[model samples]
Target chain A: MAAASAERRGPRDTIAVSVRDVGMVFGDVHAVRNASFDLPKGRFLTILGPSGSGKTTLLRMIAGFDAPTSGEIYINDRPVSAVPPHRRAIGMVFQKLALFPHMTAAENVAFPLKMRRHDARAIPEKVERYLELVRLGGYGGRRINELSGGQQQRVAIARALVFEPDLLLLDEPLAALDRKLREEMQLEFRRIQKELGVTTINVTHDQREALVVSDEVIVMEGGLIQQKAEPVQAYRTPANAFVANFIGVTNFIEGVVAARDGASVSVSAHGCTLPGVAVGEALAGGDACAGAVRAEQIRIAPRAETLGNLDTLVEGTVVDAIFEGERIVYEVRVPGLGDQLFRVFDHDPVNHLQFSPGDSVCLGWNARDMHVFKK
Target chain B: MRRSRAAYPWTWRVMDGLESLAARLWPARFEKGLPYLMLAPAVLLVGILVLGLVQIGDSSLRVLDTSTFLMSEDLTLANYQRALTESFFATVAGRSLLGSVIVTIVTLIFAFPYAYLMVRTPSSALRKFLLVALFLPFFIGQVVRAYGWLIILGNQGMVNEALGLVGVPPMRLLYNYPAVLFGLVQYMLPFAVLMLAPALTAIPAELESAASSLGANWLRTFRHVVLPLARPGLVGAGLVVVTLSLTDFAIPAILGGGSQDFIANAIYDQFFRTSDQGMGATLSLMLVAVGSLLVGLVFMLFGAGTLAMTGGRK
Candidate 1:
């Protein structure tokens, strides 16, 4: 158990939440396996994963809704493995928002305070304050169904945070919102989290949301924590192929590592040698590997001379060109790389020459842009 | 068109020809009226019921003449007057009303957990078992079930046999008000559970989790979250159980050993045993009014719950 050690460490570490070797198994299925992490006080963390990636199970365990089959979870230097969810000072916003339809926004916010035995005299004021904080000041009298979708979300947040729990867990509350509302709420969440300085853990499958909202992101797959790092680090230097593929639109070129030079490796794919940066593990000669390159990192031009000075350049025919508002994405098939389609993002779509499908184009990227990992 | 029809099977061609013929007769312009046309059968059935009620009402006002063995030429309020003033009638009416209320409350209390378990149980086998148990009673008619209780709670029954094994003598559990009420509750349990299941299922399981995570213990969660959200189901189930128990005749007839009589049994006794059609008609009209008034009160208090066909909250 992490109890004795956590007690010895005491309040000196400033660790608000410490999950140690937590694992949850449902019958024969391992939902979460040997998950461990320490979240510093006042920091926002997100467990990022695909639908069946055990992110929710991990969050549930930390929130005390679930008892981990093994290991313990500590909240502010106290072991909470045996604590029930209500006894544990944790607030959660559900995926569906789960606002009580019968109660008004203020009443919903006042619920936790009432249940937690807060002072009856101070409850109305506290509920008002939290509702206002969520920017739903005068909307308190409105029933949950009476409010708009975004307003309902604010009410849910206020309700969760009104009791001032030790930690806040968000079980993908914004997943149900439309894209525009979701993005707006993401920034709103970030602002409130910063304003309150509550140690928060959010679970989401939306990669962009994880990157946008969290100070740290823990990526999981197959009930295993694949990578845990700051958002930029997780994005720029993924731990393994799963993290690399999961985070963003990346092209994976299957190959064998020809040689390793410090942090960089040269992978020979289909008789073409591609220079790349090694990720997760060092690659020896003849080790099967895949070099991952981000869509934005690759530059596409009409001809070889048009492509700026780069370490590697390949001539390929444009397969498809998609016009996405801010950027133009072109899928290019490079014969030199064995007809593998390489995606290139044109951020300055207005200034760039838009290449149509079947047009021959030159794609180039720096060697450091490609992350080489063992297959 | 001929080539397309020729490519199809004989069944398909026949169906297509029928569809085209029907379309030709119906036409697209009359589509708006189709829904109302479909409602004709239900409306006609209700119209027939209203006509029957009118005849009953007409008979209810007429006094029965003992010497002639026929209704009097002139209408009167004699039956109503007797029904309102008589202690026997008062006791039966009071008993039915009070018994129905108790049965509704008890049935709802028992059904909430049953319906909740059926909806929320994680194990499919357990859910299936609960569903089967809830529906199995429906297969046996209410009258048959009352008889089953008569056998089970009788002096020489299984329950008394078990009690006798402990040196306790067989008790007179039948022919009492409690026995009738007990029989009614058992008969109403399935209807209550059936009415409640959908309402309970409408409530997302996540809300409970949300409630617990928001610092509500399971008991508090049930009180504050589950109970409030399941109001529709409770109201719906309560309304059904109350009305069904109120009008019930078989349970009181069989289980009460002729001592306990509900409104329906009283109506039956007047129409058959006493040979008073006017009294029977009066009781029948009163029962209809009482049932409607109860249902109306429920709608007024709880907005018709799940039974309200209106689109949800404004």
Candidate 2:
């Protein structure tokens, strides 16, 4: 990966680019709304969303392509509402890899320096230095067309970083590549963003790409930030149904919060008085929310478990089962929620699980693992 | 226009005409040569035009005075030498050439961006408006347009009237090089825009956005990225503009007020007014030769630009 070969050298890492209340209105369309965040130096922040979810629009405001309709942006604590994109010292890698086709690799990297009116004498050395940083040292004299897709992407990175902009912006950088190439580039990008100690913001729809690279992930939907958290936290304890469904596969059971208490709660769900705790906020009965539980959280067996007394346990028939290479997924039939599935890792099927589509089994998990919401 | 596949029904009148014509015309043509007979009109036109140009060249080489149309057909250099030595004719050529080159350059500099913007701007309504607005001048005759400019720039017209209001004296503007240049640009802006529009439109929007996001904003992006990619369109626009302006007669004739007549007008004078058909033919052929040379230079310099603007000849 280019980033691995790059040498780590820069000032102490800190927050450099901060976006506060950033929103953009292109005519009647609100492309982005109320987007407030800060990007720290030497770290990567991946703003992830599907198309039209506003991640690209937010990145544009950072690059100064469009000013927020009502917001302020800051680069190193200085509010840069009035600064133009070229003057803002922000490096951006477009999805198309926007390398100047007419110029060779070295000249493409040298463009930003020329724009900044840097000494022409030092441009050649500066070009070599950044090209080396991206592990594309010898490829500098080549035309952009001569390079591979991965190599062209590296050249684009070399170009953006050559300017040594305070913040580097990547707009769906790996989106155009095939799945294997994308995964390969994802690691390379994370490494390069780290090695240069340049604060980077990546925008993508690929969840795995976001989880694998970003120190923090911000998921956006419908021009609003759905949630912001580290990958593990967002995965395990999503704040809302959208967040839960967006992060990873989760089983959702409609429930009502019958009671509330500190750190834990009891819920009446599936026509039964069940016990659960709020994953985000305490809720009461009749509130509109959902209870989400991971598939693997439910342990299914022919017999009951030790937590049978305190566990949210129910006896249900295995509606179906599918062997998914590493795990077995059993679509267990619950009385109220119909057929909600439970997954168990297939370490060895002989010792752990055995079930047919119609066999009755007890699905159960501890109350601590039961995430209840008012809906 | 009739659709290609549909055929007219076979009726009695058609059958009679077909039978009679085939009996008379098709009989001889089938037995002899129908293909050459069919190709005659177009071939004859081309033949006449080429032979006419050669005859003009031959006439231009012969000796001539008002007393006799030509003293000799010996192909002397006197007519060519006399044409070269005449300051009035030479000055007309120089001023016309220089003025047109400047006008075309300025027209392209201003029109190309507008053409590009008209095409790239997101709203289809706006693009349509721009397209229609660009071609609107086409419906108006150059003579009428030239007269309109004369009023606007004349001493007692809108331009002088505005200057008078600004506490400056009304100055002579009509019947000058500037007036002529302005008239020519107005006459040719639409053509320049038309030549450039398709080329500019053909350059994908992904190209410029790609550049801007790469740490290069509008100006740097335009200079390095958009302009280079649009180089072909620029060349095409230059060729069209230069060609039109170089041979422009009506605009210069009206606005130049006899001070800035070009080769077109000079050729017309030699052929019709001055009764020097040989000199007029020489001037006309010179215009074509210079135009061809300029076009050759355009093709050599900006290959893509020529291709984009003029559709590199098949």
Candidate 3:
């Protein structure tokens, strides 16, 4: 919490990593285009994007594996465009977890220290300390193949951290594990990052992982950053349509702006006027726009009177109702909205009325919950 | 719907009938031993070789009489005694062993970088060019290649002609120890490269990147990761080059002129030139023993299954 507040008080010198308008082009393809971000000290930032979206390319530039065609990256305010990877004070966990198969666990962990020319007597103790840090204590004598998949992950983490690098980079290291193990490791990564207070930059396509483990998330698409904000802010107030749809289950209703008053806008769609807050660029009257609403923000009731207190109401038939333990997700087909489908989550597990397929229900939400963006 | 016999192609019907006929002739009970049955010819060929080796061993124990030029009826250890005591045979055996070791070492030193570059190059054109150059000599026979080398390295040849342009005299570049060693190394290069390529390919390119990120330069990565992983292939290639060069006949016979005789040249001279079959048989058995001992030593140093293709745990 103290770190979070300190990051909120953003000062220039506290920034640990800054990518200044970095771009990379391979032949004719632009792998990354003018990407720039500043990571404060002791903060975890996740670069989240789908495949071929330049997330990995940006991480590679930061790690010095590949040079950017333009722009520069700085670690601790030092311009590192020309420094080789081995000379940089950065550690990386690869997607494949490339532990040396020829060496035992302890030897693999000890490699970086030996390469850095640490004191010979201090190397073994530091390796043991890191092995125990990753919870692989007393198992360092076994070869890599003798360990399980998760244990290999532990060894990779230990090896990357034992050298005490200035920054750590994770390139989707947990992307290959089973869900249970992946979630467990996500929390483990969070714990280790917090305990060590090392600035980290993780690249992943897993949205849930980005939200769970990162202090800030950078959502990217088409080799460009769409949004860079705190996880909840990025989820609640996305910068554009791409981020809204990528981060959560968002329903976008096409409409035209009918009226604008300061921050509020009324959009006319499917013979109804839907009120929403104008976001991003200002929208003029009659301009084509979309009203983005999250599934959990809307309420579902059996009848219109039950949803009387809400500012907006619409009638829909339940197309599908899925029971997901603590909540029920109902896919409602709203006929007034051009027969578009809208998903609604009812979290009242005890008092909620279950709606079956083809049952009529009313969905309601406040106008503030809808974000209006111009098409 | 069931199809009639006419609906099927004639080739398919013939194959089906042949398969059923083979099954009936072999019977289901004997199916389990089919692999061993198929191996009978190879096993028999090896058995014949072993039998010939035993006959040679028997002959190696006998002595030839100078008056009749025929072996003695009773077996004796006279030939073995002569082979062990004679300095001429000792010098030939030592030269062969030493030359083979040098050839093996030099061949591997040249082949490692060639094979590594061939496997690691991102350009397909360069890789294809290297591959063609390596296999070009293979299509030409070894004896023809050695004769070609003689033309290239002889006085007033291309090399000497180039040297003559610089006012240097034409040198004696053929029929020496270094010439024989150089020919053996050239001949064994393709074999060594072919053996090492697969092992180098088995290592992931990502491993090198990982090493670099983990604070290793290119040289350190090669020494720590690549050299260790490629040991099995090195040992396997070394065993082959050593044994083949140790008992090699053509390179030494063609390049040695008259002075530098290896074990194989001595054996050939004993059998054909001197008309001494007993001495030739003795040299042949000793060569086999020496080759086997060297192979055994390699297997002991490395493992017996060093060249296994599976990617399982070591």
Candidate 4:
């Protein structure tokens, strides 16, 4: 709430993009509902959502690829709803990288400049500078297919940024790469974005990428913007149940609100009441709700007595245990919590005694970590 | 697993048995030679063609004795010399060359948008309609289509009848150079579209979007990106249309009214009407040389991939 208020009060001159009640309808299907947001200049914003979540549709609307069925979009305080994509000064790195296979690396990078009719004498120099920016300086003579996958990505980035567009849009450019290379490119994208200070919007389904590269994150679902906040704020305090569940690995405990006190609510599930923070809307006694707890927030132990500092504790049997190098995931069915399977992440795997399938265990979490939302 | 195998359908069992029998008969050691063995029929057919071409070459070097109505015993260059220097043959060759080139250019201009629309249309029904319209002429065969055009474009035919309805008099729309070229274009339209559709489909649609997003308008996008990328298709379609039009016999024979004789019609005239086998063979060899030269030129300019010979790799 504070961050949103700060965004509204950031002054008109600083806002690089402002979308007002933008809606995109395709026949009978509304691909994007009324979405409104303000992105401050030089801030990297990532719209994160799973496939078919309308995140790409929203980005396409902002890039002028698809006109909004309602309202308008302002880029640097200019209404650009009627402008065609070519007329808008926006660079986009498509999902497939869409590098012109016919052009050499330097030629591809010089494409935008040539199209925009930049001074012919300066195209080569600008192309070289952008290639160097993407660490492909001497590779200007190489064709697109001649480069490796990562090198092709660099060529695409150079091509997009060489023209110095007002906005840079990345449409899951790293989605096709291997994990190690994707992580490297993610950092590279952030460094270059920060260096260029271009107001950018990247659409991706990668939550870690959204958190790693963006100054702000917008989580969308079912053609609607569910939450728009800083990455940490979105992770720490999601606006609703969907945002909480979508952004991270979370376990939901179904219950009815037993009592409410200020910002916290006690949810009665199985035979006991669990304390949790109420998010998004107010709740009262007898209201149906569910408390969402992050998997890492829960601690697992062999005995119940050892979880002394936890605000809530329950006994369970390990249904499955997965050893995932850095952390161990234990799926525990807690009988005290109606035999519902609860996932608990143990961060300290080397020091802790690992639990195996069918082993008796205890799960514990604090009230602050569990966010309760009305059903 | 044994019980499942026993429970398999009779067709599956038969297929399994046949496979094992074939493996035992042919064996894995001979697997490398199987592909070569499969190509035997095509090689044999081409070998026969090469032998016939050699026969034609041998005959082309001889001159026909018109008085005795027999080819001369001794080989000579008289036939080749006569075919090259004669004004009649020269006019026919020049007309065929000019006509084929024009047909190629005009056919490609017409086929490109048709193929592009067929490949890019979002509606399956529209694509199906375009495909059906393109292939419908192919089913009607070239000779039959030329006859059909003859019926429509004749002096008192449907086209002239319509013009007559406007009180413009039944003007001659057939038996001319334009009529022959128009017939060739109509005959080659399907071939051009079929050749170009796959090439257009191979290009990723995103490349066009990328071009537009990079500040190129629709026309610039086509010139800078789509046109260059679709070059292999254009070159290929052009080659097919030109070569086919150059070698065509039926369209000119039906529509030319004996005036607009293409090279094929001239060769037919030498062999049948004039009873000059040596001259016909000479013209046949010359046509092959011209076609080969044009194909060689295209390959030199745009590599073998222009015909998709080397996987169309850039």
Winner by DockQ: 4
The candidate that wins on TM-score is 4
Total backbone collisions for each predicted model: 0, 3, 0, 0
User: How well is each residue in A210-325 modelled by candidate 1, as lDDT tens digits?
Assistant: 99999999999999888888899999999899999999999999999999978989999999898999975457889999999999999887788877689899999998988887
TM-score order, best first, reads 4, 1, 3, 2
Residue B183 lDDT (model 4): 93
Give the 10-residue window scoring lowest on summed lDDT in candidate 1 chain A: A1-10
Q: What is the lDDT of residue B123 in candidate 4?
A: 96
**lDDT at A162, model 4:** 90
Which residue runs does candidate 1 get wrong by more than 4 Å? A1-13, B1-3, B6-33
**Model 2's lDDT to the true fold?**
0.78
List, residue by residue over A242-347, the lDDT tens digit for candidate 2. 7777766667777667677875777666667666668655475566546676776777778776336646787778877878756787878776454545553333
Query: TM-scores of the first chain across all predictions?
Result: 0.96, 0.85, 0.95, 0.97
lDDT at residue B312 of model 1 (Cα atoms): 62
Alpha-carbon shift of residue A167 in model 4 (angstroms): 0.7
Q: What TM-score, to 2 decimals, does candidate 2 have?
A: 0.79
What does candidate 2's lDDT look like per residue over B1-314, in tens digits?
Answer: 35442365648558877889877967864856777778899999999999988988887776657777654656676767776898987888798779879998899888977898898888999989987887777787889888888889888999899999989999998898888888888888898888777777666676676566555678777888878867777787888788889998898899988777888888888777877766776777778888888888877776646554355321
TM per candidate comes to 0.94, 0.79, 0.93, 0.97
lDDT of 4 by residue, B127-203 (tens): 99998998898998888998899889888789989988889987889999999999999999999999899889989
Candidate 1 B-chain TM-score: 0.95
Query: For residues B152-174, what per-residue lDDT tens digits would candidate 1 score against the true structure?
Result: 99999989999999999999999
DockQ metric, candidate 2:
0.26
What level of docking quality does candidate 4 show?
A: high
What is the RMSD of candidate 1?
Answer: 3.0
